[model samples]
Target: MDLIVATSAPSLVLAAGERASIRFLEFFASAIRNPHTRRAYARAAGDFLAWCASAGVASITAVQPLHVAAWIELQTQTLSAPTVKLRLAAIRHLFDWLVTGQIVPHNPAASVRGPSHTAKKGKTPVLDASEARQLLDSIDVSTPIGLRDRALIALMVFSFARVGAALAMRVDDVYVQQRRLWVRLREKGGKAHAMPCHHTLEAYLHDYLDQTGLRDEPKGPLFRTITRGTGQLSKTPLPQANAYAMVRRRAVAAGIDTPIGNHTFRATGITTYLKNGGTLENAAVMANHASTRTTQFYDRRCDDISLDEVERILL
Candidate 1:
């Protein structure tokens, strides 16, 4: 079939347990879907299952709205609003699945509401060009591991890649043909996007690849750890948690007081480019957003919320 169905429209038919909860988890792992969404959903599901086990709930079918409500209430004590909302959404999805599978007559969680998340206020953490330079300069690229880390940071900033994408990257994914470097990313919705590498990042990548002797193993993981461990990057790309730790370590090493994490790079890239006159269309295309509004959400440049942009001057 050559037909292209819009995402808003339902294309796949749902029957009793045809898409089981366990199978849904597998769907996330195997499918080259939205890496961010996959990670979030995986974490949410894991938390729910852990809570169920601790609460003496024997099965997914045993979960009810009261249990979910209590979980949300407990989570509110420590979790941020966004985190609470995401968990609620995950639970809602689980019940929706149950209803669709005919395990439940109705979704108990369908009527439950999620926490209200506010837009980030007051100078969200982002690196300026100078700060980013200082951060990169703080790394001593003399050693092999240092060089690899430097390249990783450079590629992440230049590419505006989500930490998961960087961690998920494989050596074979980088194509250096036609006198330019391109990276293949499995983005949201299982869509593959090949973005042209900035020339600056390409140089760092070349040096890092050579130092790591990664040229021969094109199919191997892109990032690895110098110290080998069961959980360390023995062969797989570095774990997501390690990626966050790396950013934090680097920021502290640079003597930066600002809060730093994986997302700082992405937010910085979008805001910096937009402030420098990068159009919404260009940002949308580069960020691989399905809509410009999504791109705008990342470009938090602190513009005054003026009515002039929408108001009529003539009466």
Candidate 2:
């Protein structure tokens, strides 16, 4: 779907009035700045409104706390608790906006409660140090695609760049500072983070830039799509989906059976760093997390310990 500004008003919203339609659209268009968050919220709002309409609700204003609670209950039955909570939050926020604008009388979702959940560990899969090394070493960097893929993967492993930040990079984002290579990443909430390159990452990046001739075009995208037949880098920035596919394909080629995604590298990097004596505060800073509590989720050091203990109780 297009951005909220370009999209038509929902049927339930349209039934309210022109004012309600504009206010609803503005909630997504002006209230939310992040496109990804806006998309998720828009989807949640749409689903809820459609469900309300099917259940005999006449307009956006007619939605009540009971309707919100019922829908959240239904969501919990089909989706994970966190996802259901997020969806509820979207409706809650939308209603909050409508209330403030005087489009609605009150926030219906405000009083409704979502299901309870807690997470002590993140669900992202991580590669062990040896598996990570094997995957990197297995790549054949004789060609530009290989070189680009290697550099991208190394960027995530070494500097812990999120795939979005890594892909958003321009060639100039990689620069020499005091004779050491550093990468500048635009992280979430528009934060800019920079980290010095790990020695191996530095070598791989230099190889990619020098051999692929990307060094000459500093304004071009850092990670790019390959030309259809030539196997050469195109100017287009590689999308996150393509990057995910590349990693999956690479992992399979390297004989890694564990299911992995783009986020695997970030968690793997954090876990490996902590296992090698890196501080939690420093790891939090490196990952650009605002709190160490958030960083703790990625700390999977106990996983190995737990497995070893379990092995000792052999049948």
- Listed in order, each prediction's TM-score against the native is 0.75, 0.96
The residue-level lDDT of candidate 2 at 114 comes to 87
lDDT of 1 by residue, 6-104 (tens): 221122112223344434444455542556666686677667767866887766556677777888888899999888998787667755655765666
Residue pairs of candidate 2 with colliding backbone atoms: none
Error of 1 at 97 (Å): 1.5
- For model 2, give the 10-residue run with minimal summed lDDT: 1-10
lDDT of 2 at 62: 93
lDDT of 1: 0.72
Q: For candidate 2, write residues 1-315 as lDDT tens digits.
A: 234524578889888877888889888889998888999999999999999999999999999999999999999888999999999999989999999999999999999988999999999999999999999998999999999989999999999899999999999999999999999999999999999999999999999999999989999999999999999999899999999999999999999998999999999999999999999999999999999999999899999999999999968
